[model samples]
Target: MREILTLQIGGYANFVGSHFWNFQDEILGLREAGFEDPMIPTHGLNMDVLYRQGETRERQATYTPRLLSIDLRGSSGAVNPSGSLYERPPPAVVSSIHTWQGPAATFKAERHERNKFLQSLDDEEAQYREQPGDAKAEEIVDVEVNERQRYIYQSLEEEVQFSTDYLKAHLHPSSTYQIPGCWQGVTPFEDYGTGQGLFSSSARSEEIRDRVRLFVEECDTIQGFQCFVDDSGGFSAVAADLLEDVGEEYGRTPIFLFTVRPPRKVYDTLASKKKKITHALHDSVSLARLSSIAHLTVPLGLSQVAACSVAEHLAILDEKDYHTSALYAAAINCITLPFRMEAVGPSDGSQSSGLGGTDMGTALPLVSCSDSRRVAMMQASFPSPALLESKGEIFYNLHNTSSLTPSTERPKLGDRVAKLLVLQGTQLPGTTGERATVGQVHKSVVKAHEITAKTGRFSSRLATSSHLAISECPLAVPLPFPFIFGNKIGRFGNILSRTVGGGKQGRGGLDVSSVPVGASVSSSEAVLPYIKRRALDLQRFALSRSTTGPSLLQDWGFDGEESKDLRERLTNMVAAYSEMVESSSSDTD
Candidate 1:
């Protein structure tokens, strides 16, 4: 079990910083399922930003550290962070060892003692950085970035001198030590303090400290480090040589190569569009003449849409020739995403009912119709009179196959029309066990029975008087029929001589709803009932802009005080939602 758990933790750590992983998609799906913000994607990244959001701030109103675990291990073992054995669990004892060690024994106590002993050894080693035989106080000056190279030289000299003396005393042949003594080149060894914290103390001293620190002691594995600068300023000859020597000792490569880049300044050229100032960098210490590096590619404007297939095609096409032969050739093979366009209603921004805006210089018309009569107005291809009176007995057939293509070939004209008809609002139905669609494509299928009867009754009601009293909330909006419908019935006239798909001529201000077949009908019925179930789904959605309080507050421009207020409000809302759900479920029960 431990091995399996360890593997799982390792796998998680391996991808800890990987960006290409699809964490977003997985989290979005969770959001759609109604998970609260705290349990979802918001917890994944950019945690600090989220804390500023309004509601998030409120949720953390209470804080308590829950004593979440009890350690069962009772064994003595060395805790070596660098050893491979660190990954394994320590051996366990059959009985409690704390009884013998006493109540004072604890992991913290053991760790503290170990650390104190290590500190003593470190303090003793610090003496090496100063004078020998006579201890004198020395100032631990902060390293400056500008003096980094010089500092590296001084630190390396101390380390090399100490190492040479030690080697001569221990492993070196007698001759090397005798020659140094005879040549009067032997130097007393001095101890340099630990290089830790020197790199960040000050920019100048840090550079010098870091450059020579590696030579203080040899390490089995050498990790290379880098720093970026606006200009080549602190590199030195001794520093460079010491680095190369250290690298050779560790079988690593080392060199200080400087590259000069173009300075930032304003300049202009006779180009149609503006461009940023840029230039390639070249190595300074090259033995031969240097060649130019590859030019950087910078994407701009429409070219950036290459990441999306549909955007790429649209960006390339011109509006004037968008539907011409050339466009067909270009777009035919273009990868398409499922496009969905909805006529958002003004009230809820949902496609729920009658259109918004005026029907000319007149007040909005409220018309009434019987359910049966209204059903007749909604037809598939055409309406059958017998079935109209028969109620919605006959099912109307409408194909939404335009967007669909055959497995072996491209979409045809019929498929395109089918897609358009479905988008325009048509109804289709099927049973649970059916292999194909339930409705048939009859030449003159009747719409639902109730709508047909309603339209007829409405006409009869209008014929009775010139001034008809419209209801407060009528079943339908009485759009003025744009074209003249003479007493001649069953004849359909063009409401707009030209509209969008009505050819090149533009459409006049007319009630478009009256002209199109089943235009007043809801567009949702065309899809299967299961697809429409999305409306009833009780999924939690973000009312607040962000999942976290800090981020939500920051994004909505809420100040600290305002954020605190909003957070409290959100907490109340969450409580309300929970109560509502519980009440609803209780009622159902």
Candidate 2:
């Protein structure tokens, strides 16, 4: 099995060949931090690392055309006679479903289950209406727990709905054919030209903003949280309290903020007229009308679910309840779900979901506080970069593998080139412009191969660097594991710092050539001799003195004729060193 890491880039035009191409910058950063290439097996390790285990076969290499090259003018992919193109062709859909079925469906089912649990609590609350407050203490606490959980779920569902609706509204024109002059209020584009325009809301908009602040303030009180941490780790609980007091006095309860904007096609369809004939007495009226309107559309099922939940909340809530702190919280939660969206127009494709359209309805379950223990166990077992770098235990032997082992096979040309390019980070200049400079390459080669009187020594020096550099390419991808489990990592906070820190001692540093010329030698012309002397010095002392362990030269999985060539070159250098030492000794005697 083979694994292929596909690079994804945001823009192909600007970053086609640069390090930033396909997010290489981020991937490289991850590599430097100790991540390893992902391994893929068809039958196993296909699931999340939290669940999967055992050795996995890697997948074949895969690459895609740049994202920027996608044709947006009509549809996507091959065009039919009617000029229709389908984006996200069927193979992608099948792949997505096959890979994510468990994770996606589980999340949806979980939300439904949570809703049922909340409903049960509501029923229990109704039965205790006649009891005395102090006498039913146990029941009251139980009911409160249930109510709180239900509130959280309800809030989440509403937030998901609102989010979907907001997106839908943003995609469609605010005014329809029935209302020609109608506008989607509070256009985000009002502040387009003037950056400051976005911050300066109109009076009515400010009123809405104030209401939102009040709702958030009330939410804090409802949640029983007295303080919240700012980015700097400072606490601010009193600020909301003060704001609430003023809002209460004014009877201005905050409502959650909502906005909508016009669709792009509306302006594009507007007619433009340039009159060429100059009329002596012209008072002509010209009118531009939209010939046809293209309806904005998104999937229907998601919006339907969101709409149903929203309708239920709207029915239950009083006018004042609409402005309640809980309402805002609930709205926010409902709209944020992956499936939620506003219904703009009818769906473009068929309504039958599973039969024709690939099922893309589900999401991963939200990790609950109660499941923390199980999650912790899962996390502990995963192979995070920190664990690999910690050098806690050598799980796989990088250096002692058998000669015929799969791991020791000769690398492909691309792999060798990748290694050398990666190594150039340390040995040559880091920047492309610097390394690509003709003068620098000439100087580096002349200095590195000074002892050799041969004219074509630059190519030999480059080859030597490539041979030594091929050992570190595997670290370019992330390991398929987690560093820690449960509350151990504390929600993305770094917990394996020590492991990563300790392992950094064996990490690579900048590759610099040492020259052997005289101490007083100076000048660009003297560089070749100096570099040659330094190369000889390294040959003699690099094993004990260089930062990287000398054994690492064999760890990078070099094989085939390439490895033989490198070994022969090193052997010749050693012999030359011995002869030079003997000659110098004889002269001294």
Candidate 3:
């Protein structure tokens, strides 16, 4: 098995990562529930790719994600930092202290209480421990225990204020790290320079490196690392340093970075304007630095998700990180599905020439365009309707969810772009909703590509180099998944011609279980505009002395020299895309 190490930096990134892991936990649960079918085959996916098997001190088996998650102190909420596999000792009493007895005054802080969902999980575990090993008894206990938990999970919109509130997976003790002296609301970790030199401390750096080495040494064959970094703040700097260390130690391993941000809010105050400018500068600098370290960088999140075409059928709350993160997590889950798929036979119509499913090592290069384009955009269509439901339409409409925007002007003739498409659990529309075969899925994608090119949804003159992958397994909606889908979505994720009246309503009055997803990672000129915009933002702030840009950057610890270097890097990135387009134009001539 080729194992992949996952890393998540910052609170928002962890919010997205929590949802992503919940999806995986749901898949594992479904497989255990004997929910496999021809339409949704779980056996074809190898869970070992992202998970590790181990035994607890009590000789009981435990399966946990091979992940390293970092966040500010007190960000973990009710979840224990040591994890659930081991028992936690109770808080020590002040009376038990023997030292410092003179003039001692004790003040206890209130601890975060677990929500109903977590409490239910504890109750279920206790019930299981008390019961005998009879299969029927265990089944009965599970059903009874899950009843309340399911209700709470589905109704968690108001309760899930933090990532840990809805988290379903049990992380290993060593997988979580909280930065000392950094509290979410109290500390100012809002810029790239705030996180600089955080890992420079020898003790902290060595501890993180040792933990990473422990996970790496256990894997038989390590494929690469998949990282999620919060680019809106200091986490970006933290991730850059971490990735740099990983690169130095394991130079051959590939790194795929997803720089994520939450929905941006608008304000018109004078102070707010200055803050916005600071944020823009931070974003540009973070992107330039982080993208240079990772093999492939995909920027995610939108200023307003509800304004996007992808959310047309869905009801989204722009202010809620729970809703926005779920949307991004679904796309990430679908795109990364191929990384863990079991290799079987040759690649039918898939892009890669290799046999079966593609790995990160092979898949990264396909979209990166041979390293000439390291930055790419991602688009997704969630709850993609079945063929029959859409009047025999084979392909679902895709919308760009990444920050990159397509140019208003038509692309020049002979402009070539590359995209890696992953379609999951596409059904043939009808009451039966039978899963489409590999050939059917591939044909539909090709037809969609041709139609898209003609319609100029991407660009009329642009020639797209498309690589397709199809999976029979759809994304399972875990209990804790946010109810962002509309009432028009059916229980199994099919699109109803009309919205359902009412039944057992969850959040947003929808009850969706599994969803077919269409997601793609593309390397094209579409990213040119985004790169250029950031580059201009950096240059405008760095060179203009009239504005507070230089002073603000200096406050964040970026000297004049570092600011100049960042601008140069952004310039080079923009030039890379510009050169690719010119080279393609010349080849056509």
C-alpha lDDT of all candidate models, in order: 0.19, 0.20, 0.77
Model 3 poorest ten-residue lDDT run:
400-409
Among the numbered candidates, top lDDT falls to 3
Give per-model TM-scores: 0.15, 0.15, 0.87
Root-mean-square deviation of each candidate, in angstroms?
35.8, 32.4, 4.5
True-vs-predicted CA distance for residue 376, candidate 1, Å:
32
Candidate 1 lDDT (Cα, 0 to 1): 0.19
Ranking by lDDT: 3, 2, 1
Report the candidate with higher lDDT, 1 versus 3.
3
lDDT of 2 by residue, 139-257 (tens): 76987765564344335324321111111000011101111111222122121121112213364234434543433333312211111001000001111222233335535222111
List the candidate 3 regions with Cα displacement exceeding 4 Å: 35-39, 87-109, 132-150, 265-273, 347-356, 370-372, 388-415, 430-432, 449-465, 503-510, 580-589
* TM-score of candidate 3 relative to the true fold: 0.87
Model 2 score (lDDT):
0.20
Give me the candidate number with maximum TM-score: 3
For residues 1-589, write the lDDT of model 3, one tens digit per residue. Answer: 8999999999999999999999899889878877564445666788899999888889889999999999988888888877889666486454664776479443333678998878877886897799458888778887775565556766687788778888889988889998977776777887877898898778888989998998999999999999988887888888988999999999879999998888763222555767768877887888778888888999886767877777766777888898888888988998898888777675463432112377888888878875547888887777666653245566644432333222212234455667777888777755344667766676675666567678753354454465667787788888777777877777677777777745534333225667888787877776788788889999988788887899988877789898898898888888888886777766656
